[model samples]
Target: MRTNSFTLLRQMVESGMGIGIVFGRFLQVRRESIAFVELRDLPFASPPVACCRMAGRTPTVSSEAFAAAIKTIFHNYGG
Candidate 1:
């Protein structure tokens, strides 16, 4: 079964229809039925990414400010 909806995927996984793999940040693991396991032994891992603006375009004032705020927050919260 394939779904373009994450809500359906989460629902099915929670209902035991199947296991679902999701990016850690997007996984709403608030349900008691779901347990997350880290893939500690993966050969390599990619850093998380966020895209605020496209290349060659001027960043909007709000977008630029928000991006900087996110950067500061992440930097302060970095492990």
Candidate 2:
């Protein structure tokens, strides 16, 4: 089973349906019903993300800033 919802994933894990593999950040503030195990040594790559806009459209200043912020975050991640 696959879902985009973290809440549903947590609920399934808490209900003992199965285990979930998510980023450790999501486990920072969590309920006690489930025990989280961080797989730091696992060789998994994060999926690519994009900041997309319609073709030939001019980006707003806020959008440009947001893209820059995202780029900075990606560069600094896991460092």
TM-score of each: 0.41, 0.46
* Residues forming the 10-long window of minimal summed lDDT in candidate 2: 47-56
Q: Root-mean-square deviation of each candidate, in angstroms? A: 14.1, 14.7
Q: What would the per-residue lDDT of candidate 2 be over residues 4-79, giving only the tens digit for each residue?
A: 8878877786675655555434533633565544333223366333221233445578756865675566567745
Under the 3 Å rule for N, CA and C atoms, how many clashes does model 1 have?
0
CA lDDT, candidate 1, residue 59: 53
lDDT per residue for candidate 1 within 45-66, as digits (tens), equals 5443323122244557875686
Return the clash pairs for model 2, or none. none
Flag regions of model 1 displaced more than 4 Å.
1-4, 27-29, 47-79
Q: Which clashing pairs does model 1 show? A: none
